[model samples]
Target: MAELMEQSLLAMREGAQATRDTGAACDRIGSAFDDMRSAAERLVDTAAEISTFVAAIDALAQQTNLLALNATIEAARAGEAGRGFSVVATEVKALSTQTRKVTDDIRQHISGLQAHVTALVETANGVGARLDDSRNATERANRHIQDVEGAVERNTASMDMIAGLIAGQKDATVKLEEGIASTLTHVSASEIFANEVVGAVSATDSVVKAQFASLEAFEIKNYVLHRAKSDHTLWKKRLAGMMAGLEGLRVDELVDHHSCRLGKWYDHVADPVLRNHPDFRALVKPHEEVHVRGREAAKRYADGDLVAARAAFEAMNVASTEVLMRLDRLIAAFQ
Candidate 1:
């Protein structure tokens, strides 16, 4: 009978070990869920940043519409002398309207993607909760097994008395078997839960990959300083266009130091070493001067001060040159 009890106790120990292993598996699954949730959150942030870019594009479109309206008014004042200008204004207005509509569509799509990613995060949280519950149940089963082992050990220590307490020993063995059976059931349940969570994580990973693929185009940072230089060149052309009355320019279209692409990058750059570069620090003041003078140029032309407008445009050109030179230095340093 003692020998039989020893075998039963051994089986119960194995069952307990299995339960502990399952609990460890639950912990691992919970950790994976946490990682998934964190990744989903990062994707959501990326979508939000992209949405901000779309908003900037929309703002530019609205500014274009306003400029077109002003052109329309100026053309009206010019009467028959403005007939060609009026046609151009109508076309620009139509184009701006179409651009606004397209941006609106893009915003809706991004919002939908954000909603989906948020749902993915919530689902990951749910899986983590389930894993916690599984771990708790497994722990309870392990405790039960430990109790059964203690009872068997006590029975074994009093083996000489077992003949007189045969019935009691048999009863204890039956209880030990029942405890191990219960523990095995708990282990099986935990295993099932872990499998379910694995499937969920696999599905979430595919979704995250697909979402990342969709957003790959927005990571447009290659040759960013070069682009900034080009933006300044374009601004110069626009200023000349305003002076010749070849284009309608708004003072607000000369966005401030913080609103341009380079400004956005400068504000968000995570590398302290790059951000603290002397050339990087020097780019800001001249950049702001360019915008301030560009807007002044536009305002002067609007106020019919052609000479002051030309002077501001010249000053803006000088500031833009400084900005470009600093950008070149920074770019070369990086290269």
Candidate 2:
């Protein structure tokens, strides 16, 4: 009876040890399943993030296509003036098409990955949940795994936005380069036109100077006689008539004013002749009497003689016309 009791106790101990070992194995398997479930969940989350990113990329590609189409239409409408812009617009369209293709490929790949991840997560969940019921330690580890998966998903989204911004910036740079090239071409053409204008203006100036230099030299004796008739004799007659028209004519008053007016006429004649024909200097007197006999005539006009003023005005007009005619003839000989 003692031996039988001892054998029964040994059997019981062996059975308890087997159950403990089996429980430990189940615990390890649960832990492994939890790890696999977490990995599969993370993979699924990654695929979902990639799908969202790909969708966004597709949307952007659609927008780019619309923009490229608009640019192409605008360029075409501009005709020959926008030939350079048309080329750029064509390039933009090609790039947009290529981007659409890439986005489609990405979307297809992400969809496949998401399907695979979903299957894996389902399998892992089944195994982990069964193991967790068998052992409580696996539940704690599963929670920690889920936290890591969430962090990875958020980071992926941020990276997608950055990539889109970079692509947009590249397109802008291409347009800028095309605009600068067009501006340079326009500036080059303008410079050529400006040079042509300068050449034309220089030729015109040369022609004008040549024409001015064709003046003939006048004889000193003829030039002096012409000045004496126009400035002295003709001007004296005009002054005398003006004096007679005035009511309160005085000889002294006429001499003072008439002398200065006559002097101005002499000076006008002398200046041009002296400068152009220095040989005529011998004909000009240093102290000539410009007033002549007009003092008494001018005095009559100064004394409020209206008839003398009218006669003087008429005489001055006639003499001025004769002088101008002589100048015209001399200028015509030069031409």
**How well is each residue in 1-335 modelled by candidate 2, as lDDT tens digits?**
33444454455555555556666888788788888888888888888888888888888888888988888888889999888888888888898889889988888888888888888888888887777676554344344444544444444455556667877899898999999999999999988886576567546655644543342153443443344343444344345434433133345544432245334444566456433653233223311322322443354456666566555455544544554454445444444
Candidate 1 per-residue lDDT, tens place, 1-335, comes to 77777777788788889988998999888888889999999999999999999999999999999999999999999999998999999999999999999999999999999999999998998888888899899999899989988988787667636665886679889999999999999999998896676567546645754664565567644367776676667677778767867578988777877898778877888888888999988888998989899999999999999999999999998998899899989888987
lDDT of each: 0.85, 0.59
Give the worst 10-residue stretch by lDDT in candidate 1: 201-210
lDDT assessment of candidate 1: 0.85
**Each prediction's TM-score against the native?**
0.44, 0.37
> Could you say which candidate leads in lDDT?
1
lDDT of model 2 at position 273: 44
In angstroms, give how far residue 3 of model 2 lies from its true place.
4.3
Which one is best on TM-score?
A: 1
